[model samples]
Target: MTAIKPVIEGTDITSVEVGNTTLKLKQTVSLDSLQELISAVENFSKFFDLTSLGSADEGIKTEWNEQDLTQFLSKETREDQIVALKVLSDKGEVTREEFLNEMKKLLKNPGFRGWDLGGLLAGLSIRSRTWGYESPYIKEERREGNEWDTFYRIKERYAPLIKKWLKERGP
Candidate 1:
């Protein structure tokens, strides 16, 4: 029998098959919905070693400051950064302006990094497809000041350097 090695990436899941009935899973699912999924695995257990399988561990971990304001948001190591941004954007539940304002505040902190920004931008790109008229990056910059006001300003100013980075590593 071939050893069934499982590899997980972000929320995406894949399974190797040594027998019939290939396994598959949708990356986008809630923890509460997992209980129902066990039935599927249980039925398949007769053929495969389901003993190694466990509950679906997903979702984010966010905290609030003593002042009752949000301090930080965190998610599973395997959780995609874009997924986290989607959660934040959903929870904020704001109009475009309000959302951008929130992003500006989040970005101003020294701790924010390119990964965070990329995630937000990527999420915004996805959300915009359905919501319409929301450019998280531009809006985020506006919140801080202007697209030319934030670090992106320098990025734009140094277009050649930015292009080099893009050429080496496409967005």
Candidate 2:
């Protein structure tokens, strides 16, 4: 990002974080008052060049791209993991049942009927023995109103990146 230095004296704007999901404005002023931050940014917004911003990781270790996807996933991988990535990247959010159905269809296995990937271990293919640290790409959350029913979601920023990559690197 092009750092917008405080040209106007007494302006305490320190940094501005631009993310795919949300734009986080960092400043020296108190965060209690959102209005002040809004006004402060409004005054100096013209000086900001948001075009060349940094990749929005959304807490992921690295940004999702074709190159990163290859390196990150090529090591010690699982078949289910790849299938899950494909499904989640396209679907965005899939409940346990929906996910299992997709898995069954993709894998072409009748045995997957009523089967479960269970915990993050299978859902994200978390291998403690490997460099993979509970995939930064996918999130597993327990669906409300059900204890066992969980849903998988590919982070919004990564969905399209994955979809594009998968398309290019076709089966």
- Index of the highest-lDDT prediction: 2
Residue pairs in clash, model 2: none
RMSD of 1: 19.2
Tens-digit lDDT track of model 2 for 1-171: 333333121343333343332243332444344466556655655686554454322233534454565566555446676777888878888887898888888899767754445543354444422443335454344324313346778667767766776676677
Candidate topping TM-score? 2
Worst 10 residues of 2 by lDDT: 1-10
lDDT for predicted candidate 2 compared with the true structure: 0.55
Q: For model 2, state the Cα shift of residue 8 in Å.
A: 48
Q: Over all chains combined, what TM-score does candidate 1 have?
A: 0.18
lDDT of each: 0.36, 0.55
